[model samples]
Target: MSTPALTLHGVGKRFGDVQALHDVDVTVESGTVHCILGENGAGKSTLCNLVFGGYPPDTGRIALGGKDFRPDSPAAAMAAGVAMVHQHFSLVTTMTVAENLLLTQHGLRLRRQDLTDRLDEIAQTYRLRVDLDQQVATMPVGARQKVEIVKALLRDPSLILLDEPTGVLDPAEIDALIDTCRAIAADGKAVVLVTHKLGEVARVADAATVLRRGTVAGGGRMSTTSIAQLLTAMVGRTAADLDPTVAATIGLDPADAVTHRVGAAPTSISGPDAAEPRSITTSKTSVPMGETGSTASALTRAPIVEHGAESVAPRVDNESGSAAAVLTVDRVTVHRADGSTALNDARLVVYPGEIVGIAGVEGNGQSELVAVLAGDTPVSGGTVTLADTDITTANPATRTGLGIGIVPEDRHRDAMVAEMTLAENLFLGRLGRFRRFGLLDKQAMGRAAKAELDRFDVRAAGPWVPMGSLSGGNQQKVVLARELSAANLRCLVAAQPTRGLDIGAVDFVLTQLRRAATAGCGVLVVSSEVPELLALCDRVFVAYRGALAGPVETSDPAAAQQISELMMGVAA
Candidate 1:
């Protein structure tokens, strides 16, 4: 097949005591799309880093087109005809999209008009339309991803590495990306897509390689392997042999139903099947604790829903009660930086002991909605009330004071200070708790941080290490630990809480949210992954152009499908 584009033999990597990758081997042929699949922290990023020259491998060699290739840095990697689009965005939020696009291509001063024209052409060619002149900070999550992909394509590299590039894209956008990769391959370039989503791999990949704990466990043409086979190779287990206890604890039940609808209004939580034992009572406090404050480590046992169970039909709330809505949004509108509107007349309400889910395409103003709820952005026009208090104009700190918790979509950037030690970052919003006569109480903060780390079962070298030193999954736990610590939290706003987390971490986070809802805390969850929203939310709201569509019962798959269509702007 005309000399493989890239190859690795016995590649290994280590960071201090952590063996990130070990004895891995992989090969990519010319002009083909190769997909590498693995769970979070299964050494996928480590392998990519090694190939891109982020660091030298502890052992082994890399060859490009039958020649030895050792890139010392990302620049060198690009110079060797390799370009990569990272899963985590690295754009200058303050810069214009045109300016970011021009950053990669050199030799010509970027004129505003000229840059715009070029970006327009590129976007049209790839079906990735975006406002070239808009500030990235004001654009939606999907638009930012377009910028990243455009940046990589501008380089015209012979080999491209895309890391979970579709995590934030809509179905249409995903199709466009897959088409773009295929077009790249048609041009005789090699594409390596590293992702955890098996469905995407099955659709777009020509060949598949499964990685497990730092080694390539299986490799074959995509046509020869089924999704189940790929998954078995990735996790080293057969579907039938998967233990229910492990699946339940790690959040990997094969039968777990996801509740995302595409084109209809949000589904209701009421139906005969809705009475299932997911959560028996809405107000559940009195969480059981272990001796070491490590609740997560002791969660290996099967979960049991013990409170009063209801039927699966949607809950019809027509009450005129006086209990304050923990969160309230009135006629809010979100505008794009380029004068386009994202959401119009969008309203939201969250009461105690309730979980409200916002389901839609990746963009559709979900990120902005979360920001508005968290008080990070000013609503264009609307009133927001928290615990019967008007918090529409309040800042982040004020919202926090009103017992609001936020797990932002971008956990590494907006949620955690990665450069700081774990303990220091954990104590960030809890300054009052570590203060003693105006002095910082280091011991108290450490004790508190230790408790959270144990409770979340965050695996790291040590609590004293920088937060960035841990894996992606553990980094998410840090954000969750801090957000869920508000002693009297009336509401929680979690955006894509399990985006990059592993099964174990996903289970822990979902369980915590359920527990919070049971404890009279209203929770608002926004996610692109429908299954997650289905499993955790009490009711689902499909947002389209900033409007809430449904409030539909998830028990009926037909109704759920209708809602899914509505979410994607599809007509029934």
Candidate 2:
């Protein structure tokens, strides 16, 4: 009898206070896609690390090809026919795609031309497209992901592990990735898909393994298992707890109501791929896993209505000619990477005491709008007024000074200085308040920062710890601590504020944003999560190619459906 591609026997791991993984058992069949589902810290990475020689389990054992597989290092794992594409790319930014692919080769030296040609052949076979000569740093996220996958495939490994493969990809890119995965599986390789999304499990998983709090909850064929059962395992909560109102009755925040899930979970195990996991392509695609698919189809296929600006942009700030709106963007047109208009005549008015959402699929110019409004991007043609102050041409510092705070989409890029201490980060933009008579007042800043950090429930060693030391949720809280605590904060623009946050942090952030809104701060939330918009926004505007659609009332029952339609460019 042939051995399973991989096997775990009562695997357990520990790191001082935390048991990262415990009594975990898994079996992956060759030529099949096996999905390992879990919450953020549910030991998914720990389990993968164990298999990849990142670390060894304290108890039990792992076997590859029915043999004891205790790898000494990641290199040893790769040497033993295993390759992994981690959530974070490990490519050398200075090198070209062809160069990065061949860097790890031991003695098999090939000319540059030969290497490029080989890469091209592999890319063509897998339907993965990447520039051969372009530097890895120059590639977009989706393109870079393709390069990583192709590089892994170049090795022709028997076992491939993808860790959150589609975290940064757009929808079309996601579809392409899913197809690529299917193609790889078709080649009879064993694939371990680690993700938090059930939709991906529903669509492409041949087998599903649920991990809850460091242990295997259950396992079954995708055709036989249910999302409810899977979500229950990962979250330690039932499907009924997913509904905000239902959970609210039990005293839970909307964000906390759902466990690690971003959107909602599928009621049953059904979608595009409900059959036994088979090659999606000759239709192979890949994504990290499901981005969670409760609203996946609706969001991707949401009707897109392309009407003139006169149709969508009908709201006036005030009929009496008063500056009633706290934040007003009129006829904003921001450019794209290709120098096309990303925000074409986009108009909106975010008044005090209202939480407004900009909802759409990823990359419909939400980043451009955030940049332009945050004063990071120059407006090509538009007038942005903040409390009647025309700051259209103002720089970021100037706008920030005028009471506009931004929680950018990519927090590592726009929000915090990773190397700086938590206290230093907390008082980053507003250091003057901490300044003493003749020099920097470190004492005052530390005291104030510590106070706020505790108040915000940021789990940190201390204010002296660098911002990078904290987890995603804690880091986000620190960012929020800085922005929301600003004395003159009037208008807040948050772009995907909860993208990678855990449930608790998400709850805190959402609650704070709502609190800010209640305090009469004009808040603009730009997110791709339909449920988030519907849950928090008083009114939601769907963005399509820089065009802002209806100010759909959240009170309206069809708000989510309408927003989804607008995201897909449908006239509702």
The number of the candidate with the highest lDDT is: 2
lDDT of each: 0.69, 0.72
Q: Where is the poorest 10-residue window by lDDT in model 1?
A: 292-301
Clash count list over all predictions = 39, 21
Mind giving the per-residue lDDT tens digits that candidate 2 earns over 283-312?
A: 111112133333311111111112222111
Lowest summed lDDT window (length 10), candidate 2 = 277-286
The TM-score between candidate 1 and the true structure equals 0.75
Predict model 2's lDDT versus the native. Answer: 0.72
TM-score to native of every candidate shown: 0.75, 0.76
Residue 238 shift from truth in candidate 2, angstroms = 3.6
Give the Cα error of residue 438 in candidate 1, in Å. Answer: 4.9
